[model samples]
Target: MDQTTARPETQHQSVTFAEGLTLDCGRHLGSLTIAYRTYGTLNPAKSNAILICHALTGDQYVAETNPETGKPGWWEQVVGPGRPVDTEKFFVICTNVLGGCMGTTGPRSQHDEHAGQPWGTDFPPVTINDMVRAQKRFIDHLEIGRLFAVVGGSMGGMQVLAWAALYPARVFAAVPVAAAAYHSAQNIAFHEIGRQAIAADPDFWAGRYWEHGVTPERGLAVARMTAHITYVSEAALTRKFGRKLQDTAQISALGDRFEVESYLQYQGSSFVRRFDANSYLTITRAMDLFDLSADYGGVLPSAFAGTKTRFLLVSFDSDWLFPTEQSRAIARALNHVAANVSFVEIKSDKGHDAFLLDEPDFHRTLRGFLAGCAEHAGLS
Candidate 1:
C-alpha cells in the first residue's frame, strides 16, 4: 500500500484525563494528558477501534506529521488503507507514551506551577504499567469499552503485553513483535550504561540544564549511537559498510574513518536534534523495570490465566535485543495457560528492527492475523 495515497492530512485532538493516581512502581502520577492521533471513524458500536503503541523515540504520529522532526510519520508503510493495519477499515489510534517528550506530559513538559520550567529530573519515575494505565484512561475517555486489537513492536510491544495482562477483557487481540515479557539483564545493563553516559556529562546537571540554554547533546548522541548498534544485526552492519573507509581517497593514519563509524555518527547526531535526554532516561527506566511475570507469582502462565484475547507473537532471526527465545517464552506461557496464541519466528537478518522494516513474511502474517481477528469480530 502507498501510504501517501492512503493517509490524508488529518487534525488530531489533544486529550487529557485525571487518572486519579498511579500506584505502579510505588509512584503516584496525577492529571495526565495523552497526545494521540486517530484515523477512520468509529462505528456505531465502537468495535473497530485499534490501538497502536509506538516504540521508544516514537510519538503519537503513526502515519502523519512528526511534531519533533517535522518529518513524515514513522510507521507509514504498514499502517494505511490496504496496508496490514488497514486504517480505512479500523479506527487506528496512536498515543505518545506517558514518559514521552512529544506533546505528552513528561519530564520535558513544563511544570510552571512548581518551578516555571520543565519537570526534568523532578518528574516521578514511570513504568510500562504506568504508561498502560495512562493509555487506559485515554481509551475510557474516548468511550471505547474494548479494542479490536493492540499492536506494537519493541518497547511498544512491551505496552501491548502489559495491556493484555492488565486489561484482558478490554483487548480482543494482541500483536507483540520483537519484545520480551521481562527486560533481560543484558538490556538493563545497556540502558544503565546509556544513563551513566548522560549523567557523566557536565551539561546534564541532573537534567536541570535543559531550561538553562544548555542541552546534553553529546551525551544523548553517544547514547543513541550505542543503542542504534543494538537495533541492527552484525550481518547488516557488515553488509552495509564492512571496514570500508568513509572517503576512500583520504585514507590516513587517523583512526576509524570507516563507513560504519560515519553512519553511526550521523544517526546519533540526528537523534540528538529531536529527542530529549530526560525523556530518554524516563522511558528507558520504565522499560528496564518491566517484568510482567513478577506480579503474577513468578508464573508467566498465571499472568494470562483466564484471558480470551488472541495473541500473535513474532520475532526476527537475528533479533538479539529480543531474540526468538523471548517470543517463544511468551508463546510457551500462553500455551501452558491454554490460551489462544500463535507464534512465528520470521527469518530476517535485520535483527530487532525487522519488525519496523520491509519484511514481506511478517506483513503476510500480520495481514492474515488481522483478517482473522476482523472475521471473528464480524467486521470484515
Candidate 2:
C-alpha cells in the first residue's frame, strides 16, 4: 500500500463520535471529531495495529505529505516501509488529538451549540487523559480490540503514559520517549511565557481573533520563537549558529544580525501560518495539568497497579527539558509495581528534539523493542 494512494484504510479520515465527550473540567461537547490518517495494512487478526501519537504541534499526516505545508510527514524519517516503525509489518494509525487545530475538535472548531461559531475561548480545557480517552474512542470506532503498541515522544509521550495508565489491558507495548509523568515547574513556566506572548497581542481581541477576521500572528510567532529555544540545547545552538553573522561582518542594533536570531525568526514566522493561537493556549494548559500521580493518590506506582503492558521508556542525555531522571523515575515506579519495563538513555546533544532526529542508535532501540513485542504478540 503506497502511502500516497487514497484508500479506505490508508487515507485521511474524520469521524464525529456522538458520544458527547465531557472534559476533565466538567464541560461537555455535544459531539467530537477526530481527524486521523492510516498507513500500511491491518492484519486479519487486527493485532498488528500501532497508534503513533504526535507531539504538541504535530498532525495526523505521520507518513505522508502534509496538505497544509506540502512537506513530508513530521515522523517520515522514522516511520516508513523499512524504518523503525516499519509500515510494511505494522498497521500504523496517527491522529490529530483533541484540542488540536489540524481538523480535530479544538478551539478553532465550530460548535453547533454556539450557533456555528468557532469554539474559541469557550472550548473547555482538556488534559492528557482527555486526549487519550478520545483516542480510545477512535480506536474502538475502528474496531481494534487491542493495540500492538502505543508510541510517542514529548506530549505524545504524555498520551502514551496516560493510555497505559488508564487502559492497561488494551495496550500490549508502550514507548514514551523524552517525556515525564508530570510537567516540571520550568516546563510550565516556559509554556506560561508562550501563552502570555499570545495573549498580549492587540490582534488577539480577547480570544475573539477569529470573529474579528484578524489573527495574533505577531504574538503567536513570538511565542513559537520563544518555545523553539527550549527545544534545542545550548550546545546544539552554539554548534549550529554560534554568533555567526547573518551577512558579512557587521553587527547592528536592530538585533537580527546573528544567524541564530534569524533562524528563530524563520521558525516563528513559519509556525504561525499553520497554527492557530487559541489552540496553542488550550494544548499547553492541558500539558501543564498532566500529573500521573494525581489520579493514584500521590503514589505514582499505584497508577500502574495490576498493569500488564510492557513499557520501553527512552530519554536523551542532553534533553534537559525532560532529562534522564524523569525516565528513571517512571522506570522506578513500574519496578515498584513489579511491571515489565525497560529504560534507555541514549547519548545525544540534540536536546528534546533528538527523538525526532536521525539517531541510528535510537532507531535501533525502537526496532529492537518493536520486534520483541511482535514476537510476544505472535505476529509472524
Candidate 1 structure quality by residue, lDDT tens digits, 1-380: 10111112322356755554474767665557677888888988999999999998888889887754887888887798888999889999998899887767788765635755668898888889888988998898889999999999999999999999999999999999999999999999888888888998889987898657888888888899889889999999899998887665375676557888878888988998888899999999999999989989899999899999999999999999999999999999999989999999999998888888899999999999999999998998
Give a tens-digit lDDT track for model 2, residues 216-255.
9999999898888888889999999997886664666876
Model 2: ten consecutive residues of lowest lDDT: 1-10
Q: What TM-score would you give candidate 2 relative to the actual structure? A: 0.96
Please estimate how well model 1 matches the true structure, expressed as its whole-model Cα lDDT.
Answer: 0.86
Cα lDDT, all candidates: 0.86, 0.90
Clashing pairs in 2: none
Q: By how many angstroms RMSD does model 2 differ from the true structure?
A: 3.4
TM-score of each: 0.94, 0.96
**TM-score between model 1 and native:** 0.94
